[model samples]
Target chain A: MPLSAAAPRRPQAGNRAYLFITPFLVCFVLLFLLPLAYAGYLSLFKDQLVGGTVFVGLDNYLRAVQDARLLDGVLRVALFFLIQVPIMLLVALAVALAVDSGLLRLANMFRLGVFIPYAVPSVVAALMWGYLYGPDFGPLTQLGERLGFAAPRLLGDSWMLASLGNIVTWEFAGYNMIILFSALRTVPVERYEAAAVDGAGPWRIAWHIKIPALRPALLLCLIFSVIGSFQLFAEPNLIQRLAPTVIDSSYTPNLYAYSLAFTSQQVNYAAAVSFLLGFVILVVSYAVLLLTTRRPRR
Target chain B: MTTTIERPRSRRRTAAGSHVARRPRSERRSNLLTLGMGALLVYFLFPLFWLVIAATKNTGDLFSTFGLWLGEDFSLFSNIQATFTHNHGEYARWMANTLVYAVVSAVGAASLATFAGYGFARYTFRGRGPLLGLILGTIMVPTTALAIPTYLLFSKVDLVNTPWAIILPSLVSPFGLFLMWVYARDAVSDSVLEAARIDGAGELTIFFKVTLRSLVPGFVTVLLFTLVATWNNYFLPLIMLNDPSYYPITVGLSSWSAQAVGGNGSNAELLASVVTGSLLSIIPLIAAFLLLQRYWQSGLSAGAVKE
Candidate 1:
């Protein structure tokens, strides 16, 4: 009897645990769980001319499947992920390795310098970069002209995505580098010493040892980058105000959802789009984690 | 040492060869890496420096002069004054709104996340793992994706454009919750709680008096993150708030920048104010970082250096 009683837990303590967690669960359900459920509900319906929602059952999902703008947004973000993730992660890794070497003077200063931009608001960073990329009074344009080169229009249709990519990379590279550098510090020094004694160069040692040890952090950074990449909004949205002719209402999925709800007054469709985006993010994020985590096949 | 020098000629040969052989290539590479790092550093820092200089200049100098160079006039005080004064003191109201929103939301989020994290870490419950995975998924699902849905829900409740709409969403930071959970798991032991419980401390008392003290660093990290995130939140407020009077500095300054850009030559003061406003916006962040740097620095190296 005593063993069984102890095995189930002290009901009093279990009750207390329930009591403590109730607040969180309440907030979680009300804010997150409920909204998610509401989104799912909305996803199943369509707008009716009778001023009410009609149950359309999965028609919205089917429409989303064939939606060209959503597809274009996905493809655009795919391009963004391909080009930006490698560049950002490489730079972050290089900086982390350099900082971890313990040989760089003013390391803290450099680290802070790199990380400061991340602390700046994304909108402000976008604005600052937007201004920098502007043709008139833009230092980049003036400098490029002085150097006898054409100042490529950055906010136009051709390069707007790339410009946004630059802003994001600038904003987050330091953050990712900090993550990687911290991971790098955890690496045992003896491994490097052993490699050094074997006449292995820094490149060989880094590739063989540091990179392997940083796998988890690198994975985390990649996961975060994927999440952030797909949620691209503020840069394009803010820039759209200044250059709306180039950046259409559907420049990105989030923007599309925003315009749908607020501008076009298609709340149901926007909710559907939001769910579709959430689903896509979930799928891509899961795939990324699975792909990154799977052991390389022999 | 002397005995080694006498007996180990091979080791000495290896050491000397190691130095001579490894020196040139490593030195050259290090130099090249250093140069590259320097260039990257400049590329990152130059714009911020430009913003600082631009902030000091009046509107006439903003366009007529080089952005990278310093202007002759010093109108930063006037620019800040103008930022506050020009729009019926709406910028000041916006700053106040930002402070209120950021402080309340950040502190609230940190508190909730910490409490939730402690609960998650200390208790055994049904569906815990799945619940945790759900939270982690929430972290990956960009807050932007939820903006419209959240707005729709808020609008249904007639809460759009209000502080609650922004504050409510800001309070649920899955990443912050995760951090707190991880921190509490290791930092707060069951025995400590047991001792506290045995000493007649209630759960609230134990959490506030004991657990929170140990979790100060995590709290600071979360607070800083929430502060930066909430303060810089543009899209949420952009969609939520229709009134310019309720705009946070980011949106306010963005609108100012756009309007100034559109106004052509006459809106130089507004442009100058925007520049000044941009510089001002960074001060709190820099100050917070410097003041809370020990926490920030320690937060990075905490789980990082542990093998």
Candidate 2:
């Protein structure tokens, strides 16, 4: 329905509407806005022995620009995003299309089975995968030995990112698929009938009709996936126990800020790092929004 | 226009019906799709399957036996007993903590979202557009980036290390509010509100008596989403709470896994408990997801398709 048709006629409760919104606005300001403003406030100062807490005026952010560890962590997650998100989204798209195709039997079972992982906490998922990735006694290694060849070191320095990516993909692909699948369900049946009458097969119809219609939903998934990529933490943080040599304190930007504040007690610099990370996310998310939405114009 | 509320179900039926009508000519293609789905299913389910199997084995069997098959001994019951009874029943405490945090946050967040969403949808007020824009804008901010500052702010107020730290931040869910805004715009009609007002009902009464009934599905959807999010939350609690007693199952299990791997050799026994605890922690959530599958799926469609 067009939104204008649904616009409220005259302000029935006008200012009284504040009564309903007050509760949310209260929490929003206290929990979200206050901390955000405080973080900005906290970022400008430095705790130095001589001054005991002097306003440094963006010194932390200046240091962040030149900080090798922070830069490396950002690059690492950017690479992770480039490689993992496409593979994950493609898998989710394929599965969602397959389920929507009506060719699969017990589609709901497949849907639920895939979505079950999403319900499992990331902490649990990480631990389960960690146990399976155990070098000496993990199931994969034992299976490899039984098959008479040494298995590749999944938790080794060389493959840790890929291993982390796999776990993330395993956890979230089903969720993206569900989003796409529901979007598919909302397509009017008349569209399919029109395509069928035109002699298009299912594959052709899917490629031409369904996929094009899925652009907005796909864009939604892409933006969320981008945000998730930047905020990568729990999997690496948990798996750090098993592979300490490979994953360091600054493994991801979020992890970097975490250790800086909690372990190193550098709350000032950590606040700066977090603000920069949040800024990066906003810029990238906006860029994605522009790029995806711009394409349809041509 | 009343059909707007019922549209999702009817649309789903037509979508499913169309597929059945086209089934006869695609028998060969159907087999291929089925095979593809079967492989995807295994990829999705294998880790969960491994978790369940590993939870059934003793610590020795976890390493010594074939990872896929049953161990020499059936230690499932013993494993459950040990998981719950370990470390002075810490696992149970964590579970209780998680349940309280999740339930309270879900109810509060959903209720708040409903009222705000309805107010935005059905009533005209000052700052509506800008306020909604700000709320939507926050959704782009990565939550982990906010964790440190939130912790610091909470600490200043002496709310850190308490359940309030976790529950307070969780109660403001931008995505939930956005979902409700879209849902309420369609689900609740202006005419209904107008009639209730003409009959001399107060705004709050109309909401509670009239609007709230129609918004139940959206409320449940937001509730389930927040429940999962709060239950699965790790980073916030890990940083905010220093006391072990306040740990949720996520932080608790991670601590145990750390002990199993990084601790001296004797602490390796916690490995079995970790696996069993991981399995136990997920059962209730998985059950909730499966049972509420329909509501959430519709919720996603309402949010996604409308946008």
| Number of the top lDDT candidate | 2
| Residue-wise C-alpha lDDT for candidate 1, range B186-296, written one tens digit per residue | 677678888998999887898889888878877788888898899989888988998887788888888887777664454645888887888888788878877887675
* Model 1, C-alpha of A61: deviation from truth (Å): 2.3
* RMSD over all Cα atoms, model 2: 2.0
Candidate 2 CAPRI grade: medium
Model 1, runs deviating above 4 Å:
A1-12, A193-201, B1-32, B197-200, B263-269, B301-307
Docking class of 1: acceptable
**Model 2, residue A235: what's the lDDT?**
98
In candidate 2, which residue pairs get closer than 3 Å at backbone N, Cα or C atoms, i.e. clash? none
| TM-scores, all models, native as reference | 0.90, 0.96
Interface RMSD of each: 7.8, 2.3
Q: Give candidate 2 misplaced runs (Cα > 4 Å).
A: A1-8, A296-298, B1-25, B263-266
